[model samples]
Target: MRLRRTVLPSPDLLDIALAFGSFGLFTLPVLIRGSGHSPTAAIVVLGLAATVPLSVRRRAPVPVLATVSLVLVGAALADVGFTVFHSNAGPALGIAVLTVADRLPRAVSLRASVAAVGLVTVAEVTAMQVHPATGQNAIQLVLAVPAWLVGYAFHTRRQAERRLRSETQERAREAERRVRAEERVRVSADVHDIVSHTLSMIAVRSGVARMVLEQRPEEALAALSAIETASRGALDELRAVLQSLRDAPGDPLRTAGALAAGPAVERPTLAHLRSLVGNLRDDGYPITLALSEKAGAPPPVEESAYRVVQEALTNVVRHAGRVATSVEVAGDPEGLSISVLNAAPAGGSPGAGPGSGHGLTGMRDRVALYEGTVAAGPCPDGGYAVRVHFPARPVNRTAPADRAEGKRRG
Candidate 1:
């Protein structure tokens, strides 16, 4: 069987310092006492082998521990002046065993610890037989247990810290994904509202212009002018929506700032309802509008109310045809209520054909944001009606300059 060679990392500065320091400490006593019976060179060489290998103990802990143990055993068997319990050998062996417990798997490190302890004990016993003075080495055997315990404790703490860090990063990623998804839904709703309203007006005006082209040139010209105006308005709104998308911040957490980065688009409010009604009137839509505007409604609430009315009117033009429509906007201290009702077509059912239903869905989504409610269905008189109510709330208006500065800081 082929055996895998374990890759070891190059020793760093700390490892180099540790190796040299251990070497000096281990050999200092020998230098002072002098080699008793063995040659001075052999004892120094044996001390070097036992301690210097500690430098790479973290990278190849098992091998380093085994090497230090075997060298200590050889010295004791050869009857050198020192035995396995020499000042240098005991410390070097403890450091190697500590590293094995810290860096290797528990099962492998446990086996390594047992083998090291056995090897050193047998060597010390053999050396004591040759020279009785070496029997004190047996006391150092107990040091291995505490070294392994300390290293294992460090390993457990490090693993726990790594797991906590991983979970925190995953949660941050999930939150970003959710924010981006909400932004997409909001953008899509804006696009649908703009396109649906504009196209409905343009389709009606173009047909009128085509029908009266030669017989009544003035009426045709007026219809064409209305179409041009609606198209331009649609283009401006679409450009603003596109700019918002382009300017969105890369980080989902900063979505509000990203939206604010786009060029400020003037959103429709209750004041625009008069102009909206006038445009439909010009297109020969038999419509009557009544407005009772109050000032304290928030900007978001105003915009949502405008969208609900716009979508309702567009549905009237598309599905109800040229029918009498009444739009009423009433406001009190409590809240605002809007109602748009269109009578049934001259000879057909109201909303008879297949419909996408996106308009109503978008309306519900917008109203839900402000804790409002929307009701729409066919009435008893074969007419269609949409009614919406938004509860009154205090407006918190921040200056444009402050918003812009916030965006810059974000």
Candidate 2:
């Protein structure tokens, strides 16, 4: 807490101000310097020591208070040669009370402060009456209440301000975290799509080149050239996206992959499952995809809905134990549905890839945010199943349904 308060702001100046105020705190003694009974050098020294604590008031309020309050009690009781604790224990009590309130918890800090004031008040009340039974003095008794109250108010305001500032910083940090996460999602999905698609194209080209290697050298070279171009383009786009998210000490907004060119979309939607499944089947997974709707014309409601399936399938292909897989996308008017089932990879981690574990949670957040429902769990048939249902109303919709339907039909 001391470092938090002292490091960011100008602590030296604050400390100096506090120390100067400490000197002023003993004004009563200076005023009574030569009046009748003299306050000796010892009392003056103790008064100065009390002021020394004010230097570190913000740095270590509790320790400062502990030392000052103890010294204050002694200075108050002992005659100290001739001077009587500068005839003012009121200021010390008040400052210590404020320090405790600032540094300690409400209950503990309050009890200590109340005890200080009560003791001072009782001492003053007794002092006022000669041979007093209560052992109090009048002057300090009258002063303690108002001082403690004012100190408490000041401490409360400062603490409140500190809390508000901390909250604002936390919110900003959370916003930064979300921005970074979104960037990762955009980039990861893009990379997954591009790499997977390119891999397919390259594999086909390579197979063709292998056949034509001896018969048609030029054709093989042409396919190789296309591969190079595609690879370079993918790399360029990936680099741009990464640069945008980097904090490189210069232009804060790295315009690597911005939406001006439209969102960095690479991931396949439900419509692309035919090709995706074909690739997997060719690769020996022997996968089949069955859809609830034969037409397969997914609405905006099934946009993120589609990504969830892609992710689940990707997981199955990479981690599911069995080679053969079944992907099903089906639903009624209420919502769309999707599920991917494959045997768990033998001893394969439940999630074998780079999902932040928050992916499912994030998918959950997306579903809830869009007023949709989704469920993912290990299926009873010894595999994993993920189902997503996006309501027909749509997460982002404004047009009248009748007009939209007429346009669609037209």
Candidate 3:
């Protein structure tokens, strides 16, 4: 029982209807007044020629205007009851002028408008000479001015909208590029941390095993076992990082055709510090750890804190070589704080290992993401120390639930 709404016709169909309607209105009155005597077939044909071309006014505005104008002029000269200012000819020419203004360049449209006004004036004057009643046609000449102005306004608005859409698309593309660049930097830093720490441990343990192999078989075997564990852990962490890159939400094809292997491995946090410290201790580093129970933090803050400690310890083993090290982690209402200090080596100066100089920079960058501060320097007692603090903030635990609700609504 429901009724469907009617859809309107397209522009081309509307133009055809206008052409036929105008021709019928123009010829109807003459036939009525003739009372049994209709106009010649030639006059009806001329009227059809003048109005039918208007159907293509938008496609070829200049040509359609010219054709309509010429037909009106011929009809006026032959005194066949058609003039430039008649209802049919006048409106048809006005439509053509509007179309020309909207579709052509301003300079070309302007010239065409001038030529149209001149031609219509000449045709009207010619008709007036033959029929004095046609003198009132001069008043209808002003209609073209408003039509041209309206069309020009439409053209200007269309250009502005096009430019706005172009600028919007450019800005969106720029933002996407920026996000991709930042992700690259973050992933690079993580890989550096993982590879550097694992390789450093393996190099040290492999050297120990090589030196003690003939003299002490058990100790050498232990060192080799440590190397195997470190390598496996490094591989797992690297796989996790690659999986994250593949599963990133921005562009599905960003890591296209790359294999995403292995189960998801949780990112390291304060809870994983004991295992990290134990691994370093087995490698013969003299280290002490002090940790205080703290309230939960956002995932990003926890990850960054763990990296800060790991990088500090790695630097200790690489630069200070088996030195006495102490790590402290504390949290309060204000923020979380971490400090790592290592005493001066037995030798006057610590021996340098393969260092890329990017560890400390990466540490600082991670802390800065959470608006934290980092300070690293040599103490007065000839010990190196790194200190970091991250401010506390409430975590939005309901974010996942909110996202789920939004998806359901959609």
Tell me how candidate 2 scores on lDDT. 0.58
Candidate 1 clashing pairs? none
Cα-based lDDT for every prediction: 0.76, 0.58, 0.74
Residue-level lDDT of model 3, residues 131-222, one tens digit each, is 66544354336777888898788778888899999999999898667656545655676787898788889989999999999999899999
Over 4 Å off in model 3, which ranges? 1-11, 14-43, 72-90, 214-216, 247-260, 286-297, 324-341, 346-354, 364-381, 385-410
> What lDDT tens digits, residue by residue, belong to model 2 across residues 247-297?
433333533324344454342356766765765554445677886653242
Ranking by TM-score: 3, 1, 2
Residue 329 of model 1 has an lDDT of 92
TM-score of each: 0.71, 0.46, 0.76
lDDT of 1: 0.76
Flag regions of model 2 displaced more than 4 Å: 1-33, 37-90, 131-137, 161-173, 203-410
Rank ordering of all candidates by lDDT, starting from the highest: 1, 3, 2
Between prediction 2 and prediction 3, the one with superior TM-score is 3
What are the clash counts of all predictions, listed in order? 0, 20, 0
User: Who is ahead in lDDT, 2 or 3?
Assistant: 3
Measured by TM-score, the strongest candidate is 3
